[model samples]
Target chain A: MKLQVAIDRVDIPRAVEIIRQVAGTADVIEVGTSLTKEFGVRALGPLIEAADGTAVLGDIKTCDEGKYEFDLGFDCGFAYLTVMGSSSLGTLEVCYASAETHDGVMMIDLLECDEDRIEKISGFENAVYCLHTSIDSGATADPVGQVRAFKAKYPQIRRIAIAGGIKKDQLAGLAAEGVEITIMGSAITKADDIAAACAECKGLCG
Target chain B: MKLQVAIDRVDIPRAVEIIRQVAGTADVIEVGTSLTKEFGVRALGPLIEAADGTAVLGDIKTCDEGKYEFDLGFDCGFAYLTVMGSSSLGTLEVCYASAETHDGVMMIDLLECDEDRIEKISGFENAVYCLHTSIDSGATADPVGQVRAFKAKYPQIRRIAIAGGIKKDQLAGLAAEGVEITIMGSAITKADDIAAACAECKGLCG
Candidate 1:
């Protein structure tokens, strides 16, 4: 399991500082959707520089213009970029192709999507199908259970990631459930000792 | 009928120039999703300034963090911001509230949404329910037919907007269908003479 630490709602300099502290500990450093929308992907030179060889995932949450967003995100130094599962099939198809062309990763954010919708969008073999709980809707009470059911429902989806208010204590259970990536935001970044918290979560994932 | 010219896939300087030219011709000037993602809404000061008094609609297409996105967009001088109809019910609620609080407009992007979904999300009385055709899905063939069908299906939704490759010739038909806002992209912004194209479209809308 990979620990993807998400840095969100902070300015560029602060985000850079946090990324630098957690890059060595986290397998993938997520530039959260807020940062991408707030600062734009092109303006994240400092944040990208601080990743220090770790994968940087830009949560662009592309609902449309798939190829443009994917190409720009990858060009701006993101190893992975996210596209909304709610987007059109054509949009998803192009985004997946763009990811392949750039040799970058695509993560489909399955927020507010029903099982039927999920089943229909399951053809992206290379993309990570993220079982995300929306922030406004509140965190998932059972991250492990959510993953177990998602895996059973779409057993063909090999790469699974979970996000939304993920706490430190929930890390080990998600890791045990074989979730490919567990994304934590405020839990790790807002902790008193950000570095130690990230290290602990990484250790739990291991 | 209102002509909302969408400025997309262009950098800030070009966008500013386009807005300045069309500010008088168009009722609303949309800073498209591409520009918002590429240059951030906060950095659109020049475009907003050039709009003068024309309502600037930021196609933020916000799926979550409703209040945050809406507040920032309104503060950045956008009269309108978009929220995806595909977002969670909770997200829609907060976005509507944010719009009300900011005295701003919320345009709900109805991309890839089914009738049942639209039925459930049709309660926002003040919102403009935009029947958007995804760029990946290609241009809407019959803008008039699409709007007629949408209005017939959801009579409660009073404010209606339609977008996606809406051409100058199609403007009069869309206007006859009583579509409140007609969003044109490349047809206006990518024209040989942007100002003339926008004025012609505005004339057609009349």
Candidate 2:
């Protein structure tokens, strides 16, 4: 299990500061969707640089024109890029192909996708299928339970990541449930001692 | 009927030049999702200025954290912003409220939503319900007929917009079908003479 700290709603300098603080402590540092939209993927070179060798994921949340968006994100030095699971299958296929070609990772964000939709998009072997809860809908009540249910429903999906208001207390359960990545946003990034918070969360995930 | 010209896959200077050419002729000039992702919404001030008096819409395509994205887009001086219909109902509600508060319009992108999902999200009275076809899925074969079917099914949705590879020949039929907005991309933007193509399409719409 790996801890992915998502940095959102902050300017590039501040995002860079946070990345530098938590780079080695967190397994992956995510450039959140808000930062991507506010600053643009091309402008994220500083954040990418701040991460040093730690893997960086850009939560671009692509819905259409997948190849273009994926190519742009990877070109900007993102280790992983996200695409919406709600996007058309063709879009998903193109995004996956782009990821494969770029030798980067693709994380499919299943924000509002239903079971039938997920089942149809479950064939990507290397892609990480994320069970994401919308921020507007609030935090996931039982993330471990959610992962368990998701695993039971779609056992074929090997790479699983869970996100949306995840706290440190739930990291162990998520790891025990075989969650490949446990993404925490404000819980770790906005803490009083950001580095210590990330280290604690990473320790818990182990 | 309104002719909304979408400018996509071009750099900022090129986007500004295109806006200058077609601003007054097209009713709305869309800063397409590609531009928003590539250049960032905050950096679109030049494009907004180039539109002059014509409405400029930022295709932000908000899926989650609606208020934040909407506020950012609206604050950047976009007359309209888009939200995905596939978003959670809660996300949609916040986006609508943000648009209302900003005195801007919200265009709901119905890309991959089924009828049930559309019905569930159809209550936003002021929103322009866009019957969008994914670029990856190829062009819409019968846009006017698609609009007719959508209207027949969801009569409660008043402000209807259709997009995706719309050509000059389809504008009259879309207008006759009582479509509120007909969006064209490369057909007009990528044409040899963009201004003339826009003027001709505007003439066809009338």
lDDT of 1 by residue, B74-156 (tens): 88889999999999999999999989998999999999999999999999999999999999999999888999999999999
Give the TM-score (0 to 1) of chain B in model 1. 0.98
If you assessed candidate 2 against the hidden native complex, which CAPRI class would it receive?
high
- Once superposed on the true structure, which residue ranges of model 2 sit more than 4 Å away at CA? none
User: In each prediction, how many residue pairs overlap at the backbone (N, C-alpha, C within less than 3 A)?
Assistant: 0, 0
Model 2 scores a TM of 0.99
Q: Which candidate comes out best when scored by DockQ?
A: 2
TM-score of chain A of 2: 0.99
For candidate 2, the clash count comes to 0
lDDT of 2 by residue, B94-143 (tens): 99999999999999999999999999999999999999999999999999
